[model samples]
Target: MEVTTNTQVNERELWGGGAKPFSASYGKIMMWFFIVSDALTFTGFLVSYGFSRFKNINSWPIADEVFTHFPFLHGIDAPMYYVALMTFILIFSSVTMVLAVDAGHHMNKSKVTFYMLLTIIGGAIFVGSQAWEWKNFIKGEYGALETKGGQILQFVNLENDKRISIQDFAIGINSERKTHKSNIGLWYQNEKTLPKITVEEVKKGFLANPNLTIRTEQISENGQKTLLSRDEAIYKIDDATGVVEGANLIHNEYGNRLFADFFFFITGFHGFHVFSGVVINIIIFFNVILGTYEKRGHYEMVEKVGLYWHFVDLVWVFVFTFFYLV
Candidate 1:
């Protein structure tokens, strides 16, 4: 009788030599390592943001109110529409990347090239959309007043239940005050560009517009900003110390300064990643056209980048949910 001896190899012990541990190539494994590390970094940022937001829940800005602008639809309330569109485009780009990688697997160079170009175009559109959103965020539409307590006060129309721009009602009081020039004043410090309307001007305007009421950043139990009575509004206007027209590291017209801070840091970091992925996709795109990967007899590079692109898309889902939806 001839008996066949079965060899049962220990998988972990066999892969302990640090080569293709999980049936993945060196480049693919390295890409996964990078993705895991990056995921942890993003997790930390979102957690910090979560804590900060919870600590100031009542004072936090409403996502719907703050992000209301849409491209070429001025004065129309399209709350979260543009942001939703951006998310959709990013997700679609991920789909294109998957197609590109699949095509590369079959050595279909033409199909790979087509899908990659689509992926790049989608990425570029998302990047451009983000810049537009940032522009609207930095250059606020309706201006606000900052109180001595470092909180902001917005103006909303009692008649229409909508926000009103400071410029629409602010009567420009003649000011003898001029922006300080270092040469004419203290030789060391030059004043930054002054706000178009002063706090005093906003106060004067508030007093004149009986239909306009003051809205504080503090959210009521009903989840709306605590609107002040006419008397309270008048009293609150007196606490105004400076004019706030937009968001910055220092102040935010929307609400708590921390919101803007986290928004810039987290979103900016993710934006950098998207921009980098686009650049990489473009490079691979050109190489596919030039038959470089075809000569190498494999398209592992495309698969590697596809992993990163998918990771980026997944990260944005969390970001959009926690930061915007929540």
Candidate 2:
């Protein structure tokens, strides 16, 4: 007889008998595999974002300035406050999901239903808040002038040192302004909606206002935008090619265009995940009400969805740290 090898023994331990590896069922094992692969996908996205951000460290938009808006708190500078709240809501929803899973384990249908409802409510609020944030971001608060080199220049009041909106200072010129359509322009090209004011009008307004100064996109050592002197401001204003009113794939009044691109792609991807989770959670919630899992002698479905929910919440934590805090 031949001596037993380690590889043969390991194979026997793994597959020779009808034994559950790690005592996990087939569905649970498959879910873990899916989560591991999904985690790698998010990791790749965040790594790409980090590299791009480091490359444009000087000109990357400050999260505090960009995310200052809060619900029902117009004109207030609440930087990162609302984002913190959203994070709390999501984390709490994860907690409720855990409770739901625990109730499912004990076959407590009423408890599972209650916690599942809470989780769904929290997720819905988060999705709604994200939508509102996107609306504000797309409808940018302050407009800026973009140079041929794709640099953005904002305006500020020299006296009070407060940020100024292009709409607040841009003069209305009596000129025929029309959207560029494919019929009038290139057959395959169509221009985005034109800003209310043109660069020429903005130049005139800046020249007329002596108290206005220009703030470059470059971040200073003190973590503030570099403000130009009156003469320097006027000189830079001459280089203005177009007026950028909001964030889009092409232009961003905030700062670097790449920031907007990554923001849309990564956040939109995560938001889709949240929306899908909410829908699946609703389906599971109804199933719990109908006692489907109870008849099956186990609540493994709730546990599986709970795993996915926790993964989504965990991914958001890293995302928030990267996009908002960092």
lDDT of 1 by residue, 1-326 (tens): 12322222223223447544677666788899999999999999999999999999888988888788999999898888998999999999999999999999999999999999999999999989988988999988788989999999999999998888999989889998888888887476788889988887888888998999899998999988899998899888999999998899998999899999999998899999999999999999999999999998788899999999999999999988977788
Summarize candidate 2's per-residue lDDT along 1-326 as a digit string, tens digits.
Answer: 24567655544435335676887777788899999999999999999999999999988899999999998998999999998999999999999999999999999999999999999999999999899889999989989999989999999988799999988887888998798888887576888788889999899889999999999989899988899999999989888999998899999999999999889988888999999999999999999999998887789899999999999999999999999999
All models: lDDT? 0.89, 0.91
**In model 2, where do residues sit more than 4 Å from their true spots?**
1-17, 182-190
Q: Assess candidate 1 and give its TM-score to the true structure.
A: 0.93
After superposition, the stretches of candidate 1 with alpha carbons farther than 4 Å from their true spots are: 1-19
Give RMSD to native, each candidate: 4.7, 5.8
Model 1 residue 211 CA deviation in Å: 2.3
Residue pairs with clashing backbones, model 1 = none
Q: How many pairs of residues in model 1 come into backbone collision?
A: 0
Q: Give the least accurate 10-residue stretch of model 2, judged by summed lDDT.
A: 7-16
The backbone clash count of each candidate, in order, is 0, 0
